[model samples]
Target: VQISKKKFVADELTEDGYSGAEVRVTPTRMEIIMLATRTRAALGEKGRRIPEWTPVAQKRFGFPEGSLCAIALRYKLLRGLAVQRPCYGVLQFIMESGAKGCQVVRAKSMKFVDGLMIHVGDLVNYYVDTAVPHVLLPQGVLGIKVKTMLPWDPTGRTGPKKPLPDHLSIVKPKDEILPTTPILGQKGGKPEPPTMPHPVPTA
Candidate 1:
């Protein structure tokens, strides 16, 4: 089960309207996952000293997790479908594997999610200057995800979304985009910035 398709960012139909969830354009460190191909990031300014990517749960639906694999060189989960969303802030994704090899993988959402965000599109501001973590690996510990959009939205509705730039898409991989920089250097080493639009998880 090798990664068949991947999308760093692309245009998508949000509840508010049409906007681009540019994962690369917006500056937010993220930890991406392969199971459902989800992207998540921190909320506070002083995020975390050591980011964690732990598997929460797993169940054999039909496919084999042993076959699911991440690209050794890439930093994002592979995707085979464009504009993919399972449910509830995107519970799963489609693998469009072919260019690299393979065809497709599982259907439902991932079994495990370590500190994955539930739906944080509004707070994903480029001007805010955030570091989103993304998981580059599949099974084992992967690289920090540099993403903008969060995966879980308890309400399943992205709060207030902004008009995406003419060239941002949540379905395409464009590492060319850069994250916004902090307001100032640690000259005085003051307190960290405030966390905007904090997402409250619903049990």
Candidate 2:
């Protein structure tokens, strides 16, 4: 079954008795496009639409027409609706390492939005790291909790809250321990790195 492609949809009601999303298809494969209601409102305020096709994704993944979706996922893990622009950050602390996992975040760069400057906290998001080749995180000594950008912005404030970030709820942490990595891949940093499938003792 296909998901609704209507704009400003709270949720698409799929037909029953059919297997819903049997697999966790990447953003490119599924005919269904999920969206956060908060993003829809934000885009709607600007007279934009949702459930649209991704132009770049189509070129990269080579999927069928109207099969892909350009969802406006909330930037909870990155920043609160800050300047509505992308910022660079690293994973200061990671929930799971060496695998497909959520990305706990800290802003490596800063920006101003709504007349205030936002900073980092116990917040995180999810991004597949292309460099390290594993689900990677920010590289630093501090740890913070961040959340996934939800369908709605409950707090309304752009700055990060003091509690654990929201994305953790989507991807739960394993009993496994994650290790620490220094800037530029330096080995002489932490005592032990538990993020890997096996632990390595530091010298």
* Residue range 1-203, candidate 1, lDDT tens digits: 11111132111112223223322222322223322222222211221211111111113122112112222112223221221221111122211211111121122232222232233354444211112223324455433221223222235333223433342546776679665875553676776777899799999
Against the true structure, candidate 2 reaches a TM-score of 0.16
Candidate 1: worst-modelled 10 consecutive residues by lDDT: 49-58
Best by TM-score: 2
> Which whole-number lDDT from 0 to 100 does residue 139 have in model 2?
41
TM-score of each: 0.15, 0.16
Clashes of each: 37, 23
Please report, in order, the local distance difference test score of every candidate based on alpha carbons: 0.26, 0.30
